[model samples]
Target: MSHAKLFHPKTPEQLKRAVARCARLHSGTEAGEGIELLQTSYENNAISWFLERAKELPLGDYFLWFRKASGITFEDKNEWVPELPVLAGVNMAVVGQLKEIASLSKGHLAVVSNDGRVAVVMDSYSGFLQAEPSPEEIVYELAFWNSLG
Candidate 1:
């Protein structure tokens, strides 16, 4: 069932839909406790770690330099493990969705998931990533989505 070679860049709208499909698939798992953990995590406590060591270099080599130094792989090439997919699908989809909506120089408003997790990482090209709790919040959503499956 591996299709790792088939990976492609998914659009925000497509990723949003794929994430929804994954969420629905997750819902079918019938694991209420599992579902609830992500629910609570997304709803209340998402943490976004600001990497002082991972800042963009003067030459716009932030990601390259950071990858070589810290190795956290924040915004490098987002590849899907088509063979052993994480969260069955949601994480890959979310990475794609978040990249589209959050990583750009002029990022869009927001992207939401079926589990009710919301993300808004805007205006990041000019500087490093900073987390601010909106009238709502984020990494709780990230951790929740990451924790699924």
Candidate 2:
């Protein structure tokens, strides 16, 4: 098996644990072969800091602005055939988790599933902004969990 590192949380439990760890003290634990969880301080939250300066725009608006500002349109929303209600359930669960962590700004974390791949345009009011498909590529991870059922 390939030891690919995971940067985003794939489940509610995983997201919860990551939030807790990211918020609390970190001892440089080994998440995988090349993943290292580090303690994030207020100073490290430069994106959040910068976002705060703009009075916290909506996630969609921010996404658009990011695209315009950077002049780079990322991947388009993919089309996927969901497996009945499982995909929807997993999407809701994961989105809820992200919102709970205060990492979501508005209900704009559009989760699109297609061809066994999940895409996300998630954002945070805390200045945690990403270009597209989510910075850590975690939004696309819903496919893995959805496939388990």
Candidate 3:
């Protein structure tokens, strides 16, 4: 299975860059052969398009999600789960870590998370992605997915 995670870019430009880097990162890897990005406009709101996509997924179910740093917040029931606060509110620390990954990758980071709390950073030049989640995050994500059932 493809590793899934939340993505939050700070701006549309970052989103675009991230997506492009994702496309490149996946284009070469056998595991990512089918990876694709749905083109969306970010003219008015930076994450409006992404939020709409997130809304389409079933609540409490694990799905690939992302938001930008300093992005808008969603009300309860508008995010991955009804009880969980908006991803923006709870995931800034994760986003902060991702920002460091992006910088280290030289802006070639694609925000694919295997769990909502962890990110798999793809290095475009090397065509490798890595996210070593803490044991606690792993167990939490397992519980989270189990709760979805």
Candidate 4:
């Protein structure tokens, strides 16, 4: 299942280059096939568009969530579970994904590559740069699906 938080590479620039290499490699000359296991979906040669946006995306703490029309956070029941924050006057919500998050994650790490695609990875023998929309479109996409329900 997709996690409730976001994660990215500890080394953004290096990861960016790795993704570029993934794009340039001859078809079937790829490294990560199990990249599909990283997230929920897979698309071959899908890194181009995401790479463009993520290329210069500076490392920053990015927290993307949807504030319900009622202002309840996480879109949970309004009166049932009042534990979730109101998301309105809150001075600080939970900490967001930090720049060095990769190192901090024990496993099931989520790395947002170029643009918004996410690669939930564990360093494999093949390589990185496995990306997809597979619920990996985080932050700006954070509350995306939640909105529909």
In order, candidate lDDTs are: 0.24, 0.25, 0.28, 0.27
Separately for all candidates shown, the number of backbone clashes (residues 3 or more apart, or on different chains) is 2, 5, 8, 2
Please give the lDDT score for candidate 3: 0.28
| Clashes by residue pair, model 4 | 50-114, 54-115
Better of 2 and 4 by lDDT: 4
The pairs that clash in candidate 3 are: 4-113, 4-114, 5-113, 7-65, 7-66, 7-67, 8-67, 9-68
lDDT (C-alpha) at residue 133 in model 3 = 30
Residue-by-residue lDDT tens digits, candidate 3, 1-149: 12323223222232233334444544543223323233212221213322332333233322222322222347742222211111222233233343333333322223322233322222212221235333222110100111122
Instruction: Write down the worst ten-residue block by lDDT for model 4.
Output: 140-149
Residue-pair clash count for candidate 1: 2
Q: What's model 1's lDDT at 126?
A: 21
RMSD of 1: 15.8
After TM-score superposition, the amount by which residue 112's alpha carbon in candidate 3 deviates from its true location, in angstroms, is: 5.4
Instruction: Return the TM-score for candidate 4, rounded to 2 decimals.
Output: 0.19
lDDT of 4 by residue, 1-149 (tens): 02233222122342333333333333345553323312223222222222232233344332221112111346563321211221121111222322233233222122333333332222211233335333433311100101011
Selected candidate, larger TM-score, 2 vs 3: 3
Query: Which candidate achieves the best lDDT against the true structure?
Result: 3
Worst 10 residues of 2 by lDDT: 61-70
Q: TM-score for model 2?
A: 0.20
